[model samples]
Target: MQGPAVSGEEEPRPLLRTMLGDVLRRNRREQRRTLEDVARAAKVSMPYLSEVERGRKEASSEVLAAVCDALRVELSDVLAEVGRDLAADRVRRERVIRLDVALGRRTARPARRSGDTYCLAA
Candidate 1:
C-alpha cells in the first residue's frame, strides 16, 4: 500500500488558532492559573482545554466565549481578534478568486443579458 503523497506546497499555517492559543496561554500565565484550573472554571474538560491551548483544536465561538468569561476577560476582545482574522482570510480568498477569474480557471456569471447578448451556462 502506498502512503499519502506529499505536495510540494507548504501546509497553510493556522494563524487564528495560533493567536488564540497564545492569548489563552498568556492570560492564564498572567493570572497564575493552571490548565486544570481554567478548565474547571470554564466548564471544559482538561484534555480539551489543553488541545485548545496547543492550537490542536478549533473551538466554536460559544466555547471560546465561555473560556474567555472564565478567564475574567471580555468576549469582545476575543471576538475582535477573531473578526480581524476572518476579515484577513476573506481578503486572501477574494484575491485568489480574482486571480482565478483572470486566468479563466473560474468564470463570472452575467447579471443581466443585453438586447442581443446571451449568458453562457457555467
Candidate 2:
C-alpha cells in the first residue's frame, strides 16, 4: 500500500481507517476502559468493535455514533481530534524538509513532479 518515497515527492497522507482507529484506541485507553465494556454499552459485538479499533474493518456512521456514545465522547469531538492530528502531521513533514535544508544535507537534484505541479531543481 506504500511506495518508496523519492526526493521532492508529495507528502503521503495517512489512511482514514488507520487514523480513526488510532483515535478510538487513544480515547478508550485514556478513560481506562476496555473494549468489552464499550462494546457492551454500545450494543455492538465485542469482536466487531475490536476489529474496528484495529482498523481491520470500517464502521458505519451509525456504529461510529454508538461507539462515541458508549465512550461518553461526542462524535464531533472525535472528528475534531482527527482533524488536529492530520494538521499536525502536515506540519511535522514540512518541518522535516526545512531541517534537511538547514543541515545542508540536500544536494542539487533534477526537477521532480509532485502531483500536478513540478518542483524546480535546486
Candidate 3:
C-alpha cells in the first residue's frame, strides 16, 4: 500500500536544527573526543560548542565549517544536508502555490487545451 500523502507547509526549522545537533553529537561520541578537545580543534569555546550540540544556538556557517573540519569531515557534507532540507522546503512552497491556484485564491492564467490535453500556460 502507498504511504500517507504529504502536506505542504513551511519546513520545520527546529527539527532540522535538532537533526544537525544529533549528527554532531553522534560523530563526536563515535570519535571518543571530549567537548573540550573538539572546541580546541574547532577554535571555539567549549561552552559554545556545547550549546551548538544542544541545539540551543544557531551556528554561523563559519563556525559550522570549523566544527566540521575539527571533526575531520568535509564542510560540504553538512552543507549538502542543509541543501537537501532547503530543497524539501522549496518543494513544500511549490505545493502550496499549486494549491492556491487550484482554489482560486490566487490568480493564474488559464491552461491551454489541445486534443483533450490541458497544459499550463507558459
Candidate 4:
C-alpha cells in the first residue's frame, strides 16, 4: 500500500509495475494491435494480458518474453525503455527533494501519533 501524500509535496515515485505496463500499452497502441491479438499470439489469456497492461498484475519473465515476442519486440528493448523511464522519474524525485530541503520543509514521513515508533528500515 502507498503512504498518504504530504501537503504541497510532489507525489512519490511511481511503482515499477506501473511504468512497465505503460510501456507495454504504449507499444501495443503504436503497433495498432489489440489485446486479443497479442494475447492469442502470446498464448496468454486476454484478461491476464489486460491486467498486466493495467498494472493490476505482475507478469513472470516467461510471460513477458512471450508478450514481447507477440509484439515483435525484444525483451531487452522493453527493459531498456523501462530503465530510461525510471531514470527520468528518479531525476524528478531528486529535484523535488532538493527543493523541499532548500525551503526548509520536512520531507520525511507524514506526522504520526505521539509515542508511535515507526521503523522505516528495510
Candidate 5:
C-alpha cells in the first residue's frame, strides 16, 4: 500500500472550504444580504449556512454551487479569487525566503511548538 507523502509537495496547504466561505460571505455582505436572505435563496437552513460561512462546516459541491447561485456569483469567480490570494501569499513567502537566504539561514520553516513555547532549533 502507498504511504502518505511527506515531501515533494511544493505549495502550502490550502483550506478549500474556508476560502470558499470567505468569498461567499464577502459577496453576500457586499450585496447587503443576510444569512436569512441567502440561505432562503439557496434553499438551505439559516444555521447551516451560517456554519458554512464560518468554515465550521464542509459543504458539498452542490451546496456550494447553490450558495454561489444565490449570491449571483460564478463559482469560477470564487475559485479565481482564492487562487489570487494563494498567489499573493506565495509571493510573500518567496520574499521571506530571499531575506532568510541573505541572512544565512538554510530554511525558514516556523519553529515547532514544544508545550508552553516554540523550540528554536537553529
Candidate 6:
C-alpha cells in the first residue's frame, strides 16, 4: 500500500505495522514457536494474532505487550529495532535519490503527470 501523500504525490512509505509484524514473526521463528503457542500464551485468539503478524491489524498497546510477554521479549526492544530499521531505510532512499539527481537520471522536481502533480521523496 502507498504511504501518506507527499507534495500531492503518492509515494510508498514503509508501514509500521508491516515492520513490527516482521520483527515479531522473526522472533517467533527464532524461538521455534508456532502461532498457536504464542496466541495461547498471549491470551489472544490465533486468528487475531496471525492478523497482527501479517500486518493486517494494528494491535493495541495492551495486546502488543501481551504478545511480547508471550514471546519472552521486551516491547521496548522491539520498538528500538523498528526505529533502527526505519532510519536505515530513510537513509538508503535518500542516498538513491541523491545519486539519481547527480547522475542526471532524474531531478528533484520531475515532470508533472497529467494530474499536474509531481512526485519527490519526502
- Measured against the true structure, the TM-scores of the candidates, in listed sequence, are 0.54, 0.68, 0.54, 0.70, 0.65, 0.69
Descending-lDDT candidate ranking:
6, 4, 2, 5, 3, 1
Clashing pairs in 1: none
Model 6 regions more than 4 Å off: 1-11, 95-122
Better of 2 and 3 by TM-score: 2
Q: Which tens-of-lDDT digit does each residue in 1-122 have in candidate 3?
A: 22223463343444556657767887889899999999999999999999888878888889988999999988677667656766666554442234445455756656767766534321
lDDT of each: 0.72, 0.80, 0.73, 0.83, 0.77, 0.83
Off by over 4 Å in 2: 1-11, 95-122
Estimate candidate 6's alpha-carbon lDDT, on a 0 to 1 scale: 0.83
Clashing pairs in 5: none
- 1-122 in candidate 6: lDDT tens per residue? 23333255534678999889988998999999999999999999999999999999999999999999999999999999889888887765442234354455755566657869534553
| Per-residue lDDT of model 4, residues 1-122, tens digit only | 22333355666778877888889998999999999999999999999999999998999999999999999999999999999999988755542223444456776856779899743321
**lDDT string, candidate 1, 91-122, tens digits:** 44332223344455756664765676633222
Q: Give the per-residue lDDT of model 5 (tens digit) for 1-122.
A: 22223353455656777776777888999999989999999999999999998878999999989999999889899889978877766654442123454466687567767765532222
The collision pairs in model 3 are: none
Q: Write the number of the candidate with greater TM-score, choosing between 1 and 2.
A: 2
All predictions: root-mean-square deviation over Cα? 12.9, 9.4, 9.8, 10.2, 9.1, 8.3
Write one digit per residue (lDDT tens) for candidate 2, span 1-122.
22233455766787777778789989999999999999999999999999888888999999999999999999999999989888888655552233345455767765767766544232
Which ranges of candidate 1 are over 4 A from the true structure?
Answer: 1-14, 79-122
Q: What TM-score does candidate 1 reach?
A: 0.54
> Worst ten-residue run, lDDT, model 3?
1-10
Q: After superposing candidate 4 on the true structure, give the runs of residues whose Cα lies further than 4 Å from its correct spot.
A: 1-10, 96-122
Ten contiguous residues minimizing lDDT sum, candidate 5: 1-10
